[model samples]
Target: MGTYETAATLDFVVDAVPGLSSTTLGWILVILAAAFEFLGVIGLKKYSEHKTLFNGFIYLLGFGGAFAWLYFSFEYLQVSVAYAVWIGIGTAGAVIINMLFFGESKSVGRIASVLLIVIGVVGLKFVS
Candidate 1:
């Protein structure tokens, strides 16, 4: 395991599972973060020549959402599961968010990637 994995493992037993309200709010935060981040990336491409106020707001919202999720994910959920779930969940969420916001195609190519990511998350138990 890497340093992050190690530290996350160390934290797993120490942190408490957040309450229902917090967990619900945490997931919303993560999803919002992922959505805004995607928007920010797309905005970056679209507004490359000239920065726009909306683009800046997207970046700020993205960071804010991610910050909130990271705080709860690490402090409340602990590292190992939180880190793994963060990537997997965020990645999956990103795919859907892209579809929603940009009308991005979720063809077999993209679907496969999401499934593989899901498999990887499931496989983490074997390693840990």
Candidate 2:
């Protein structure tokens, strides 16, 4: 079979599994991208504290992986939706990580703001 036809056939076969589709796979990639973004954020924090080749490598690897995963997700999701969701998750996750691990502020307002961000991300998922 030709490349396009082979790919379509594979997709059809994969889609036969319950609760798994191209769109589902796309969302999965988005989540993975966010996870890699978190890794990048942590690497950034470490690199800021200490300038080292290893830390720099970690930072580059995390961010590069994140972008690669996000790019692939675009094939299965709307560009706008994918980009926004990715940013939203990354932003909120970074805030939380800072608060938890970096000893940043953990005040009620900050917590509430994080909640708002989470809600907004969920809303986007539903609307799109």
Candidate 3:
């Protein structure tokens, strides 16, 4: 298991966002981590044929970013509620990414799905 307190992980976030407001910073970290997660998973395409040191490093760093995202996520926002919002944001982002970047279908049904997801996210906004 990778140590969470390692200098490398700490350095990563500092590199990414230097400094930011608690709420804005938290959202940025979460988005960055999620994007990294997407790329890391997509990297598996290369893992089977030609794996390189850089890709391996990316994989490791992706998890590190994710851990840091969670750290800041709870630091600025309430855990349960923040997580609920993160889920919504993550879902909507994944769908949009899939549609635009991944060339997946985004018909009316898909658009509606996205809207519904945002609604769920908005609901949490209204909550405490």
Best by TM-score: 2
Which 10-residue window of candidate 2 scores lowest in summed lDDT?
5-14
The per-residue C-alpha lDDT of model 3 at residue 44 equals: 43
Looking at model 2, residue 3 earns an lDDT score of 62
User: TM-score, each model?
Assistant: 0.53, 0.85, 0.60
Kindly report which residue stretches of model 1 are placed more than 4 angstroms away from their true locations once superposed: 1-50, 119-128
Mind sharing the TM-score for model 2?
0.85
Model 3 lowest lDDT segment of ten:
6-15
* Candidate 1 residue-wise lDDT, 1-128, digit = tens: 55643232223323454444444444444455455556555555445546788876665666566655565545444456556756676677668667766688979999899889888866763453
Estimate the TM-score for candidate 3: 0.60
Candidates in order have lDDT scores of 0.59, 0.87, 0.66
- The alpha-carbon lDDT assigned to residue 53 of candidate 3 equals 80
Model 2, backbone clash pairs (residues 3+ apart or across chains), number: 0
For all predictions, the C-alpha RMSD in Å is 7.3, 4.0, 6.4
Residues 10-121, candidate 3: write the lDDT tens digits. 3345457657556665556566656665655444434544688877776667656666676666655677777777667766876787688668897999999899989987
Q: Candidate 2: give the clashing pairs.
A: none
Candidate numbers sorted by lDDT from highest down = 2, 3, 1
